[model samples]
Target: MRKMALVNQKGGCGKTTTAVNLASCLAGKGRKVLLIDLDPQGHAGLGLGVKPDQIEESIYEVLSGKIQIIEAIKTLEKNLDAVFSNVVLSAFEQVMAGVPEREFTLAQGLKEIEDNYDYLIIDCPPSVGLLTFNALIACDEVIIPVDSSSFSLNGLGKLLETIQIIQDKAGHELTFRILATNMDRRTNFSNRVVETLRARFPRNCFETEINTCTRLREAASAGKPIAEYDQHCAAFLDYQQLMKEILREEAKMKAKGFALKSFVEAKEKVKEPMEKEVAFIIEAPEDAGVQIAGDFNNWVPESLDLTHSHGRPVWQKAIRLSPGLYQYKYLVDGRWVSDPSNKKRADNLLGSTNSVINV
Candidate 1:
């Protein structure tokens, strides 16, 4: 099954809204979908018309191993099933701390029922914590739901950094896409933020934007996706466009291959001194000097100073490393940061992160 988790460290970025409506809209297209609410807030279930009191067995129970997944999976409607959550999920992190392979708890639970659905949509909580990690471990794609507000914009970098950390620990990288949510198309500020995002990450941002609509808010209150609540609204149309884009992207992913960060596995590596040149590029607008430090050059940051990349707002350096896995990080100006494009990463002993490259 195809899996994606709507995640953002900052709250009120429409994570739950996107999860509920996106799942519903995909199901509307006759694809069987399972909406899993990992947020303790239970907003996804509520939005899907499942009352909190009505949830006897929830995701909390399944993750904690108190019950099997089949017991928690509830049929919400035609072509759609739901695994709800409750406030009790808030304590799951502390409870699972001593458990073995804690990060894979949700993944292991979902494996049993994965074949039963075409898609599994996860609504992650607003914090950077274990629950979010569980959601990340359980899904292949990480869709960052961001509002047009500057607060949400600023938090994007931190969230990206955190994902890098999770990717390294998971021993696999995940592909991420940005979804602009709650955008007020009529407002100049909102339009500017959308423009900034498109310019900043032109290839990673989705063309479809979720607009601010009173009908969408009413649909949430009415416990339904906008498609089910009112198909004529702009919200439904926007989601329809998004669904189309997602399906197209999924088709490409299937044909091209799964994009696991660097797409290199240890066992899959064939020994050949096939030294190929690759340039690591970064957009460091105001930085005076940008350097890269990795195992290919004794981890010396000063050994590889990147030059300007063809007058673009980027710094780049080319290296000929043997076909294998390598981990590195960028020294931009004075601050060190992971290569934002390379999602595979691991934490360094120096309290920073190293971006991974498989070549």
Candidate 2:
């Protein structure tokens, strides 16, 4: 089975909505899909009209070893089955704190039902915790749903850091793709955010963007996926395109005889890097023309231009710097500005501050 998880540390990023609708769309395509509600909020189940309280068992029971994974499965449609969750799942972290291999609990549970479905979609919580770790460890692919709001972009780095930690510590290399969600095409700011995301992650972003639509909210409120609620709606079409894109990628992987398990095993044998690649990211308008100037480059303002995929607001540049203390600032539109994202700053001779970084 091909396993994928919808994960984002920020709330209201359409993580759960994507999980529900994506799973449904896959099932609608005649694929057997298992939707796992890993979030304690249980929004995934609610969106599909399955009340967590009404279910006899949930993912909590499966992960906690109170019951087998199959026992907690609730059939939602002909080809879609879901493992629900509830507020009680919030205690999972504390409950499994001292347990050995706690992070592998969910992975082990899914072993028995590996062949029962063609796809496994997990909806992770809005926090980086045990449950999120389990989902990440179990899934080979991760879909990071990012909203159009600039605030949503702030947590992307932290989430990427968490993913890197799982890969380095658990020996699991996961492929992730960013899906732009909650986009409002009518507004210039929303369009810019999407454009920036695509540029920043040229190879890691999906072409399909989920536009903001009230019908999507109505569907969730009415306890249904967009596919079932309004087949002709724009949201439904967007998700349909997403499903097709995923299937096409799957086809390409199969054509190449891709084996996720073997790939991960091979990756585990790779050596660690001696130097760290530090990324400098800043938000600015598309026309800002941002660049990084630092002591490493003799404070040359025009030495390194922050490059992005498309020109939106967000701009970033990654450079390998050896262990040392350095100070830098961004040259935006010929004006110098300290990194707003970095709190560590040093006062210069001019009385202004420069961002400090120790690598």
Candidate 3:
């Protein structure tokens, strides 16, 4: 089974919407999908037309070991079964704090029914907390939904860092990618942000962006997936394309012989000297001095400024650093912005984050 988590630390970025629509769309394509609402808000279940009061067996019960996953899932929509959530899930931290291997509980639970579905879509809450950690631990890959806004890019760096931290602590090799959503192409700023994202995160960002459409809002209000509401809507088509892109990417990763392995065990097998390189591609403007600032440089400005060697606006700068986890961002004319060029970021208190390169 293919497990994926729709995650983003910021709220209102379409994380639940993407999870519901993607699962429903994939199921419509004849794939068996299990939608797991890990968020305490229960929005994913509600979107699938499952009423809160109607949920008898939920993710909360499954996590607390009160019931088996088979008993918790409710079939919603054709070829789709969902494990809903409730506000009671907010107490999960306190409830499961003393549980042995708390992070691995969800992973173990999913493993029990791993072969029963083609896809398991996990909808993570807005904050990168214990529930998000459980989703990350349980999933093979993660899809981040980012709005085409400045703060969206700004918050991305920190999200990626948290992923790295999880990978380090859990020792699992999990892949991640960013999908830009709610993109308003008519606006110049939105277009510019897309361009900025494309230039920096070419490999990690999806080619398709979920376009802004009232029909999407309508679908949500109606408690129906986009594909079920209107397959012809731009939003529906976008998700279809996204599902295709995701399948293709997964195929490529499998062909590359990348299996889900514990990074801790895997690291012990690697003895080669790590090569470190820092490359920055500026996206804000020509006058932007894209400097690397993060924990590595004590968040100081001018620590790693891109050289304007070519004279013309060559938008990128490269640097080198020691082997360790690092958080950084491009300082564009005194404004702290994430590498729109990169999709991976981590959460931090300053509302800024950086990417991690093992080397």
Which one is best on lDDT? 2
Q: Residue 40 of model 1: what lDDT?
A: 92
In the range 1-359, model 2's lDDT, one tens digit per residue, is: 88889998888889999999999999999999999999999999899888877967989889899999989998889999999999999999999989989999999999999988889999999998999999999988889999885444447757876887786666766877899888888988787777555534445689999988889999999999999899988999999999999878666555557653343333334323555889888888766778887754435554344455565557887887656677789988889899998999865434577788877
In model 2, the clashing pairs are 199-309, 199-310
Alpha-carbon lDDT of model 2: 0.83
lDDT of model 2 at position 7:
92
Every candidate's lDDT: 0.79, 0.83, 0.77
Candidate 3, which segments miss by more than 4 Å at Cα?
A: 250-359
| Each prediction's RMSD to truth | 9.1, 10.6, 8.8
Q: TM-scores across all candidates?
A: 0.76, 0.74, 0.74
Candidate 1 ranges beyond 4 A from true positions: 253-316, 319-359
| Per-structure clash totals for the candidates | 1, 2, 17
Q: What order do candidates take by TM-score, descending?
A: 1, 2, 3
Q: How much is the lDDT of residue 213 in candidate 2?
A: 85
Alpha-carbon deviation at 140 in model 3, angstroms: 1.7
Give the Cα-based TM-score of candidate 1 against the true structure. 0.76
